[model samples]
Target chain A: DQQVKQNSPSLSVQEGRISILNCDYTNSMFDYFLWYKKYPAEGPTFLISISSIKDKNEDGRFTVFLNKSAKHLSLHIVPSQPGDSAVYFCAAGKGGSNYKLTFGKGTLLTVNP
Target chain B: GAGVSQSPSNKVTEKGKDVELRCDPISGHTALYWYRQSLGQGLEFLIYFQGNSAPDKSGLPSDRFSAERTGGSVSTLTIQRTQQEDSAVYLCASSSRAGLNTEAFFGQGTRLTVV
Candidate 1:
């Protein structure tokens, strides 16, 4: 009964290329979606987020797109650098219960030089 | 501290032993949360505490798990008679407030291994 799912276990991309990571969710009550990047031996850091009301949100090189109808979302990193390599976790939470986050298994992204 | 702090980065305890993990949230944060991450699995919510209200214990897996927050600041998670399945990285996080879409800052986590 996983409410969120990251179908791809891993993704690889060349330097300066665009890398896309996808995630899906089964719970319609989730109105807020967040992406967190985690390095080895460290806690996850917030990347970007999107509300169900918006289709897309962009910050610097990172962009997140959401499709409420499809119950899907994707993270895009343009000009991906080697530093961008890490595990990306997609988490969802309802507005009412913002403290509880349902996370996916996560997708490991590797950017090669 | 500038960020959430979790003590005992790693701990190994024998089966049936009790263990206590501690978490220190940011100075003014009013919300704290506990989560567990098993190998190859996603983060699982365990419990949450918000501004003096009754803590949400719904996510706690069993009676063996319990947590308490003192003075709305520090929090401690206690596991009684730990089992092998209790092994996991226990994480603590805090936000300015709860139910506001605020991002929670996390600690490095305490890795608990039950042998």
Candidate 2:
């Protein structure tokens, strides 16, 4: 079963504009969420993350909003740059099992110059 | 001084052959994990190891797949009697701790193809 889902396979946005990527999860046991960005021929790197205790977490130009009621979360990048183009994977894990994460298929985001 | 490093950047073997992929995690990171990414499977968790703890092998797909971490530093994933389904990029990751949702650093990955 697809516990974590990224419904959109691809997304496109203009540079310097705001970009939003969405993800949903079916597992209520998950209390922690993370977003990872990956470029071609590289591994996914952690971008930002949020805990279920808070509704939002922000760092610099990146902010992650969590809506526990909706079982959804989103990553927002302001003043998007061409370098932001990559595949983003949403991951979920509970405190147990040493935080073994379950990840989505990933969304390919393209920032146009 | 370094991040996770995986060796044999690429590997090709015939069916029923055996293959070994190695990973060197960042110094002092005690938690390690192995995952496989295939076109058909997307990405699947295979195994995990934490310092002096029994690995969680629940994600391992079959009896043909196995992994070992020695001295809590380097890990090796071994596949015996490989099948075409084993073709995929095998990735290794490490974190500073076992829990608390630590940020994981991934290796460049070893691409393994079973012909």
Candidate 3:
């Protein structure tokens, strides 16, 4: 069973535009969510995360919004740049002892210059 | 290394042969994990080790797959009698602690191809 799902396989956006990536989870027990960005032949790099208690978390140009009731989360990059083109994976995990994360299939975002 | 390191970046093995993949976690990190990623598929959890606690092998797919962490530093994942379906990128990650709040750093991954 896919606990986390990223329905969109790929997305394209023009440079300087906002890029939004969405993710949904079936497991309500997950209290923490994370986003990772990966390039070809490279491991994923941690982008940002949010706690279920909060609705949003922002760092620089990247922002993550979480809706506990909807079991959905999204990553928004304002004024997207070409360097932002990569595959992004959304992951969910519980806060306590269980550190294992359930990840979505991933969404490939291409920022066109 | 400053980050997690996995060796044998690419390995091609014949079916029925056994393969061993290695991982070196960041120094002083006590938590380690293994995951598999198939083409167009999401990362699949394999196993986890935290300090002296019993390793969590619940995510292992089959009995043929096993892993060991010696001295709580380096880890080895062994696959016996590999099958074509076993071909995938094996990724290793390590964190300062075992918790959702800590970020896990991942290695470049070892790509295995069973022919």
The alpha-carbon RMSD values of the candidates against the true structure, listed in the order shown, are 1.5, 1.7, 1.5
Q: Candidate 1 lDDT, tens digit per residue, A1-113?
A: 98999999999999999999999999999999989898988877788888888999999999999999999999999989999999999999986556688999999999999
Q: For residues B36-115, could you state the per-residue lDDT of candidate 3 as single tens digits?
A: 89988888889999999999998899999999999999999999999999999999988897753446788999999999
* lDDT values, one for every candidate: 0.92, 0.88, 0.91
> How close is every model to the real structure, measured as TM-score?
0.95, 0.94, 0.95
| Candidate 3 positional error at A96, Å | 3.2
Report residue A7 deviation for candidate 3 (angstroms): 0.9
Candidate number with the higher TM-score (2 or 3):
3
Q: Any idea what lDDT model 3 has?
A: 0.91
lDDT of 2 at B15: 98
Worst 10 residues of 2 chain A by lDDT: A93-102
Which CAPRI category fits model 3?
medium
**Model 1 Cα lDDT, one tens digit per residue, B1-115:** 8999998899999999999999999999999999999988889989999998999998899999999999999999999999999999999988896742346788999999999
How big is the positional error of residue B71 in model 2, measured in Å on the Cα after superposition? 1.5
TM-score of chain A of 1: 0.97
> By summed lDDT, which 10 consecutive residues of candidate 1 chain A come out lowest?
A92-101
Best by TM-score: 1
